[model samples]
Target: MTLNVANCQRCGKVYLKNMYGMCGNCIKEIDLQYDKCLKYLREFRSCSITELSEATGVSHQLITKFIREGRISIKGNPNMTYDCEVCGTAIRENTMCEPCRSKLAKETNQMHEDENRKKLREAQENHNTFKIQDRLKDRF
Candidate 1:
């Protein structure tokens, strides 16, 4: 695999880019925060993400990232909800709500169909051009 040198998004330090965008130091700090948040949640199982963030001094954004990564689970908690990434609808799990997902699926299918039609038209045009060239060659 190729490694690219990039400035860390968190600390602005130069480092070899891997799976994460942050430098080693920032990654270590985030790991520490994750551990702290996990411990706090284990002790206070009923706490919401915002409450856990306040109690542990971690950001709610990081807690949401943890939830999305499946590092933390907010199961059985109706109060713990996240907005869909595509739509503003409240969702219990995943990035997108069901309606948004269905809409995107239909759009994707339509796009594929349009692309296939374009390719077919190009192929037919090429075939007609080849046929014309063959007819000209026979006359010569």
Candidate 2:
């Protein structure tokens, strides 16, 4: 394991970087909030993210992070839904919905293909230029 020195993202305090980007104090506080959220969800299993945030005094952003990390799941609940990061489609888990994921995958593959084609074209042009220069030198 490598130890890295970095400033805590949450509190801006200098500390050793761990798996979590936050400092120890912030991590502890987040853990406490997680516990509270878990306890609340146990009682009200179908609450939306906003409702949970309001009830537990935790921020919606934090709750969304917890959900994305698989620490919390609100599956099969019609009232609870999160927007996909790419297309704003409602999703039950992860950052993107299935359609968006597929679309993004296709787009990424196309981008790679385009970049490869561009490099190939440039290489061919450079080779042609070199060949022309060699022919001119022979004539001289």
TM, every model: 0.70, 0.73
The Cα RMSD in angstroms, rounded to one decimal, for candidate 1 relative to the true structure is 5.1
Stretches > 4 Å off in candidate 2: 1-5, 76-78, 119-140
Give, for candidate 1, the lowest lDDT window spanning 10 residues: 74-83
| TM-score of model 1 (CA atoms) | 0.70
Candidate 1: residue pairs that collide = none
Tens digits of per-residue lDDT for model 1 on 17-74?
8689999999999999999988987777777767888899998778889889988788
How far out, in Å, is residue 66 in model 1? 1.1
lDDT of 2 by residue, 11-49 (tens): 999888888988899999999999998998888887887
| Prediction 2 global C-alpha lDDT | 0.86
Best by lDDT: 2
